[model samples]
Target: MRIVATNPDQTQAVGKKLAALLQPGDLILLAGDLGAGKTTFTKGLALGLGIKRNIKSPTFTLIREYKEGRLPLYHMDVYRLEDGGAEDLGLEEYFNGDGVSVVEWASFIPEELPAEYLEIRLNKDETDDNKRYIDFNAQGKHYEKLVAKLAE
Candidate 1:
């Protein structure tokens, strides 16, 4: 599914909708350039998950855990990770944990990803400052259905 977000709020609204379909052990891969609103979308996802606390990008800390929500939210940012460094983080535990996992700059550690996941790519529009082109690529049957529902 592809969506055009006219502003940050719309992007976050899309994330909120997507979050409703998430389940434990689900993986979300986010790809986009700097200032592409990845964190904003995640904020909306957190809200959808029933998380009430402030949501911030885990750029420096690498991973932030929020367990107060309906399900735990393990948000990760691997932009600073060097090639092959993801192995040391034991990320598999989180990926398979009883929560949803969202990874920013997921392309940085493609080898560490599981076989099934939902990849969301955000691209900024050159013509509009707040506009973004969001693309959703679903892998595996569950994600396929999730995407289908979102497309509806």
Candidate 2:
């Protein structure tokens, strides 16, 4: 599915909607460029998960864990990771843990990813500074159902 966001708020709203459909062990792979509002969308997901604390990108830290929400949110940014660094982190724990995982720059660690996941790709609209084009692609039956629900 393709979604158009006129502003950061809209992008976040989209994330909020997706959050409602998330389940434990769910994986969401986010792909986008710099200043693409990936963190903004994540903040909305945090809110939807019942988290109230401040949310920030984990670019330098590699991963940020939020447990206050209904489900734990393991937000990861592997942008700085080298080829084998992701393996050292034992990412499987989070991906298979009792929470939802959102990986930013997921392409950096494709080999570490699980068999099923929801991929969200965000792109800036060339004509509008605040506009974003978001695409959602499912990799498994569960994710297909989730995307179908989002469509409804």
> What's each prediction's TM-score?
0.97, 0.97
Please give, for residues 30-137, the per-residue lDDT of candidate 2 as tens digits. Answer: 888999889988998998999998999999999999999989999999999855588899799999999999999988888999889999999999889899999999
Output the lDDT of residue 29, model 2: 90
Per-residue CA lDDT of candidate 1, range 65-114, in tens?
99998889999999998556899999999999999999999888988999
Q: At residue 121, what lDDT does model 1 achieve?
A: 93
Off by over 4 Å in 1: none
**Residue pairs in clash, model 2:** none
- In order, candidate lDDTs are 0.93, 0.92
Worst 10 residues of 2 by lDDT: 81-90
